[model samples]
Target: MMGNRRPFKAAIIEFNPCLNNLNDNIKHLLKEVTEAAEKGAKLIVTPEMATTGYHYENRRALKPYIDTIPGKTTAAFEKVAKHYQTHIVIGMAEVDVEDGLYYNSAVLIGPDGYIGKYRKIHQWATENSWASWGDMGVPVYETEIGNISMIICMDASYFESARIAAVNGADILCFPTNSTGGSLSMLQAWAEMNGLYVLGANRSNTEKGYHMIGASTVWSPNGEKLAETSYIEEEKTRNETTIIYAEIDPAEYDNRSKRRLQSRQPDLYGDLMLHIGPWDFTKYELIKEAEDVQGNEMSNCAALLQYTPVIGDKKANLSKIKSLLKDTAAETKPKKGLLSLVVCPELSLTGPVHSLELTAIQQLGETDHDETVNEMQKLACMYQTHLVFGMIESDSHALYNTVMLLTPAGDIAAKARKLHVTESDERWATPGKDIVVTSTKGVGRVGLMVGYDAAFPETAGVMAVNHADFIIVPSCWHGDYGKEMALHTKMMENKYPTNTMTTWDAMARFAQAKTLIANFTGTKLGCRGGSAIYTLDPIYGGETPIVASSDKEEVLVVAIAQTEKDCWFDQNKLLLSRRTHYYRPLVKKFEHVPMLDCN
Candidate 1:
């Protein structure tokens, strides 16, 4: 058994295979595996459909390339694994000969021979046209090197795939993909959020009409890139073969993984399992068409107030907030039928607190009936808009970091206490239990989250499952902290800064929801004020923030159109595509993974 014996090498092979050329592709894959194994890589992975290639016209076109487990392809890979005494993961189109079913699958081969396989669960639109939905659930295999899990190309787009692997005790997530855009950021977010290593082996060059960006990468548990291939836009440079390696030490960040598991409130994630969207795949029927969908035609003018709050000075902060609200109301008037939404940063009333003392927390905390809330309600009424902002709420003896929504009707529509709290918040604030989504006059259903809560995909996922049209975030988020900063820097360098708007952008794309984040500009308090609004980009199948703020105080306003026409597939097709029955691990209490020493 390879029991926690220091750090071992892991390799990701980025290769572009010829369509339907199985023999040549297998020969090339074997050569790469041999080279990586000789270079001391105990764990080696290849891109999705490495042997057969991606983007087939239909099932008949792919049928010739499909092989059953323990078939010829597995036999060839098993020889390499046994010879090198290494574990190899390869993506291929698998056919269950008995059932005559085809699936996009990844097979894991150990030194002993065939170990296990994970069928791609979440299918992209193109994949749905041919491959059947993965029937085998996400599985983690206990190996001497540590627990390992495998997920294919499109599965990386969904948070539940990685989250399930993590909860199942996977130390390393091997992702083999033929994905084109924004793939690295998605992998990094998965690594950071799940607190596990993500090794993505992506193909290079264009297959058919789909251009796969060759940036195979290995991410540490902290989401830091250990190694990555260059992502050149030039078609010629994109086809180059590359092999990136990173040392895998499963125990290095086991604590972070353990903490994430312990902090998960699975009971509150019931929505994740329910078919609660416009279309229900369980019934194989469309509940609403694009035009018939409620709130699709409604456009709301939204303003994000990015400003530093005067610490411990609620009166001053309220004055500045009110001034901004008044200016926003006057400057950007919504159309006659549209509504307006104004969002403020987390702890906008009292700012971020440095004191950990209970008395200090209690003194700074306010109730829904407090003068500050009443003042905000008055502003909402006066401006004839919905106001969203964060504050410290004192409910009896407990202190919670909460985001409140005040409607133009002069009422508190919804209040969502932050479910995922930072270390500093643990000293003075209690983590909330419920996820809140409120239906409004024109905004449809608006969901609420605060600062760090947006970092967790499940939080937004719950809101999305509840059919939230707009997910508003009141955050004091800083740009310099967290492992995501590495990804943020990389994204900024690539001129795709919107991809760095926290994990909310990815969630917005997956959940088909609009996300508006308002943040503070207090450098001293670790807030860098990168407030923005993210929406689904139909052209690229990703997300782009329509309006963004710098590290300075400013009120940015834009008209946000929430439409079902921008759905990932058909009207609400991505929502309908979710295989919730296979997601039992997500809502269950995490069990102790045997491979890692949590203590």
Candidate 2:
């Protein structure tokens, strides 16, 4: 479709591209991509990893599967692309030279030749074993048809990934998916909220114990199910692939939304850098930081945290908290640490002092989403720090554990609901089931953190491993087994490549930042302590802390130099890396999680 108004002719190829069976996959892709293009689809989309099916268990096992464009897949597609004189967005398993690990990349080919490729920045399931994560952003390529950005299956789930693409002016978010039946509804809704035309092309078949529900479709800017692979229709013709044609126009996007870009506020989110690349030098300072008693000349960075009572009364608590923060802020103006931050423990505003706090809960307890969110923005701006705090989430239900990030510039960058609901957490909260990332010019991109979230190492580690500076964990610590030991295990197991580091100091030692675990100190219940500021090197193991304050409100400032993140090769040597060309890489894997309409 050209626009919601124009009835333009187009085709949607529900490509059942052979996974692992490259020769056949190409034979199929070449035929369909060309046929669809010739059938008058200015833009044609295919299923995820259409050229090569997703497959892989180990690096060595995957070596035989990987290949670059033009090797076999591209050579075949090039003819289709040129001869048809159309633009095509298709997925393939690629070998990045650095680590030798394969990448799920969607290469954009214009009629003239190959354009840039948008690598899948995110992955699913055992995908990490064979393919490393991609580093580039969701990019929209210009073509005669219109402006389009290609997004792989899972990548579309994250709001950050798509928002960035839209911010770059993508008229259509064309996704090549391989998903199960259950997830279809959610993806359709996503298209409507952003006023985007989502061309989600999913595959059908089984691989690595997973099978997809093939119903590729086109979603209009208003989210109308424009075209889907109708099983009934295909069955009649014995056709597996369905062609969905639609018209898209640049004007369908929300004009009001551009206000965010015209007034892009990067300054307020400066300290939010710890949200993305974890390896800033500042995060290391929090391990055991205290002002130079003798004025030993502190580092240029200040690691700051929210002030809380150390098991005391209101006045006594306020006095102590004020002194510590005031002193920290003055001593370290603009904070020595480049990554400035302040994390509020779950219920930081008022200690979990008593259950009565719940009665007063309506003020901003677990159930007060709107009010709490509003207050957080106010609190963050006043504090002049990149403030990320935890509080009880309130909705129709009693409560749910949740976290919110209030950028210093007074914007809400991102938020996360606790996925791992514990007894106490469940006592007042519902398990949060979504992932969000906020883009900031300062530290780059940061994300929200909730307590017990660290318990799902895969959830946290995968997010961190993919894209995130640091996770701002917000929760109250209880009786010591070292009660938080479970949290440590979760962190260790899910950290990355392999769960290598264990403790804050351990993470500090490994990743070069205490802030990675910088927020809290010695685990204690019935008392508030351990609030911190810090950074983690790109690798999860290298953690370090810059400045830390226990039970106090303070402005921990950071002055970080924008740094380049490490590529896959920096860690995995090619010989040991899993290159898809060398072996068969597993196609995408995952049963999509259910999420409410969080537009």
Candidate 3:
């Protein structure tokens, strides 16, 4: 407990089924959870499929017992949770209307009413015929007991599920299982690896006639086996009966629970739409280089993240920005009068690292403002080029990290702010919820996603579907880009040529691959440092931009061609061919207060 902590209590209930008897099943659960809370417990986690049991072998024969998430099963638990001033995470079957299928879902309810529902993503052997997977990815909930994440009977097998929960900072992870020994070991392994407390609620008996060994157990984040119901060890198939009881200190689970941002490389996911059309097989050739160019090939793009030190000498930083932009203008020179565009990073004028009171530069200071931009516009208008850059956008109580893009016509096209803020930025910034996209006159539809904005793969995916030909990410990061790069490289190694790879090469490769995601944002988070263009696959020379790691200011140039190859997501075969979840981080549980997040 920390200064003035709200100490919440939790218990694990032993569930045994009386085949299809909902009345008796309800009576037993109410008795067990009520007794636990009467002793001051605030939450009680129940066993998996305890109400109807896991006897799906005859499910089609007994459709009468089936129900929806908001039906009787959920209604019963809702009343119980509220009456006790406690919370309950209950497992039940749901007929998902989205896909017209039944799914094993866990519902959480506070004293008030329903909290949220987590439909099981993974299913057991015969479960496929009975249910459909939940497409929300993962549903993590906050409760009076603690910030919790649930994995149904079979969901815990995948390492990514637990990794995601730990990565997002879960304190108490509740697992409601309807399994025996082999499955029990798997749950224990997950809890130890994640370094989060877990409650294992296994049914004593199932309607399917399988006898549960009923070794209801609990484990700390570290793999240490802590408590289990006192029972005679027996074969998993043997039927047994026992009630597990233990007093757990929620604060103990809070140890080793710290979260921070490293590099989140979200671009590798293939879910985003990056082309003007979804693989219409249009007229464009794969340009291996300038020599391989066709009439329809568009020039590569230059996406820049401008930077100035928060407290350093302003004159020097601004001068550096000017020199960098000048070089960038020279590099994106388009052939035959059609220029490549420049999309700049957010807060390039005044540093994004400081408070509004310190770094808010309202104007570019006369000569520094329109004078420099006029020069940029003249170059764009002269060389027939474009640029989307950033400036200090401020008004009253706020300042924004904006992207300023100039077309060949030499005018501002689009602007947006960083949508999310971590602890490091909460003291200084506000949130931008929606994304911004602009249709550049000749360049097609282009979108903007700030640094933190890219961490969520959906941001890019949504833009891609809406008509974005390309996306710009101008970022600044102090997190680990090495491990993520290595991970992504290993995943895509066999699928694509290694080309040039040191740790730096892999970092750049993963960043672009993640962003160019055909259907899902590839591992949506930043995995490398530096800034550059993301050319979708089949455009030739691979998918990433120039790998930039040095603190020194520089400009990167990429020529994006208008190709006939469709965006990956629309082409299921293409998406299936590549390992989209490339380079995922996996780690053992650290057991300490600050747990390991596969970093």
Each candidate's lDDT (Cα)?
Answer: 0.77, 0.51, 0.51
lDDT (10s digit) by residue, model 3, range 276-296:
333544313211222242344
TM-score of 1: 0.89
- In the order shown, the candidates' Cα RMSDs to the true structure are 3.8, 17.4, 13.5
Indicate whether candidate 1 or candidate 3 has the larger lDDT. 1
Model 2 spans > 4 angstroms off = 1-8, 97-99, 181-186, 231-239, 250-272, 276-599
Q: For candidate 2, give the lDDT.
A: 0.51
Q: In angstroms, give how far residue 279 of model 2 lies from its true place.
A: 13
Per-model TM against the reference: 0.89, 0.46, 0.46
Model 3 regions lying over 4 Å from their true place: 1-295, 303-322, 325-339, 352-376, 395-398, 421-434, 455-465, 480-489, 494-528, 533-546, 550-552, 562-568, 571-599
lDDT of 1 by residue, 129-175 (tens): 67889997899997878788998877766678888888887778999
Return the top candidate by lDDT. Answer: 1
Model 3 is weakest, by summed lDDT over 10 consecutive residues, at 516-525
For model 3, what is the error of residue 406's alpha carbon versus the real structure, in angstroms, after optimal superposition? 1.8
Q: What value of lDDT does candidate 1 attain over all alpha carbons? A: 0.77
